[model samples]
Target: MRVHIATDHAGLDLSRYLVEELVAAGYDLVDHGPAEYDALDDYPAFCISAARAVREDREAGLDSLGIVLGGSGNGEQIAANKVRGIRAALAWNLDTARLARQHNDAQVAAVGGRQHPREEALEIVKAFLAEPFSGEERHARRIGQVAEYEATGTVAGRLEELRPREFPAAREA
Candidate 1:
């Protein structure tokens, strides 16, 4: 599987560590920069590029996933989710990481470096990589609900195409 990772200054060190780990694990990796650290560098640009690469490649039927890291991962995930077809999940622990992949079929994982120790972060990432989507009926149904929301800006179990009518209920009465 191919993995792409991107981050700004806050995550630079962790990102570099992950690169070495992933490369050693024999997975193809794409590392989006700050090739050299810049304190003022922004996260969204790098995160967006990496996240977009994964979505586009996956849409083209390439087996790929992405990682966006930051001081807290909140901004990175939010930016990644802005790209249509990218389900980015923030992973704080092994269970959450696994569930993000198993239940949501997320293609991008957001990691918060400042929130967890290096070992714990690595474990969470490992869990994310190891888990597969369950594809069970319930999981599929829930994912479908999210997909509908993504595509239509609404969700299932909500009123559809509500039309305002003055006293329309009078006819029914």
Candidate 2:
């Protein structure tokens, strides 16, 4: 499997460590990186690049996945999810890592570099890479619904269709 990784300065060390470790573990890795630490570096560009690569590779029928890292991982996760067709999950532990893949079929995982010890974070990434999607009917149906919504901005419900529109004017007190 091909594993793509991206991170800002906050997670630069961890990201570099992961590239070496994952390579040793026999996974093909693509590093979309800041290359060197810069305190003011942004996460969106790198994370979005990794997510886009994963989406494109999958679209072309390749087995690929992504890993995005940051200080808290929240922003990285949010950035990765902004890419259409990307299901990015924040995984703080082994179970969440496994479930991200098993339940959601997430192609990308976000890890908090400052939240755990190096060994623990490595274990979390390994768990995420090791688990296979369950491929159950319920999971597939739910994923399909989400993908449909992403594609059309509509859902099969009474909720209003999502679109760009002005909000109602506020009432005077």
Candidate 3:
């Protein structure tokens, strides 16, 4: 898999570490940078760039994913998600990282630089890259709902399925 990564000044060291380690692990890595750390740099530009690259590559039939890093990863996740077709998930642990790809089929993962040590972060990224989407019926159905909402701003088909199910306890009340 080709991994595209980008980060702000706050995540510069972690980004570099990830790039090196991921490369050593035989993954094709692209670093969309801040080649040098600049305290005033913003995360949106880099994060969005990485996200867009992933989207484009996927559209072109290439297997690619993105990593956006920042101090808290919240802003970076928001930025990456702004790309129309990109699903960016904030992965704080191994489970979240794996679930992002497995359940959501997320193409981008946002990692908080200050939240975890470099080694732990690397493990999270590895788990994210290694996991494949489960492609189960329910997960695909849920993901389709999100994609439909994203594209048309409306949900169609099976309104009854979307309706909230009443609880038996409420009926008893």
User: Against the true structure, whose TM-score is highest?
Assistant: 3
lDDT of 1 at 13: 87
Index of the highest-lDDT prediction? 3
Estimate TM-scores for all models.
Answer: 0.87, 0.90, 0.91
Superposition error at 7 for model 2 (Å):
0.3
Which residue pairs collide in model 1, if any?
A: none
Model 2 alpha-carbon miss at residue 53, Å: 0.4
Candidate 2 accuracy as TM-score = 0.90
lDDT of each residue in 79-101, candidate 3, tens digit only: 99999999999999999999999
On a 0 to 1 TM-score scale, where does candidate 3 land against the true structure?
0.91
For candidate 1, lDDT tens digit of each residue in 13-64? 8988888887898779999887988999999889999989998888889988
**Tens-place lDDT digits, model 2, residues 43-139:** 9999999999999999999999999999999999999999999999999999999999999999999999999887899999999999999999999
Instruction: Give the whole-model CA lDDT for all candidates, comma-separated.
Output: 0.88, 0.95, 0.95
Relative to the unseen true structure, what is the C-alpha lDDT of residue 129 in candidate 3, on a scale of 0 to 100?
94
Model 3 CA lDDT for position 150: 92
Model 2 lDDT on a 0 to 1 scale: 0.95
Give the total clashing residue pairs for model 2: 0
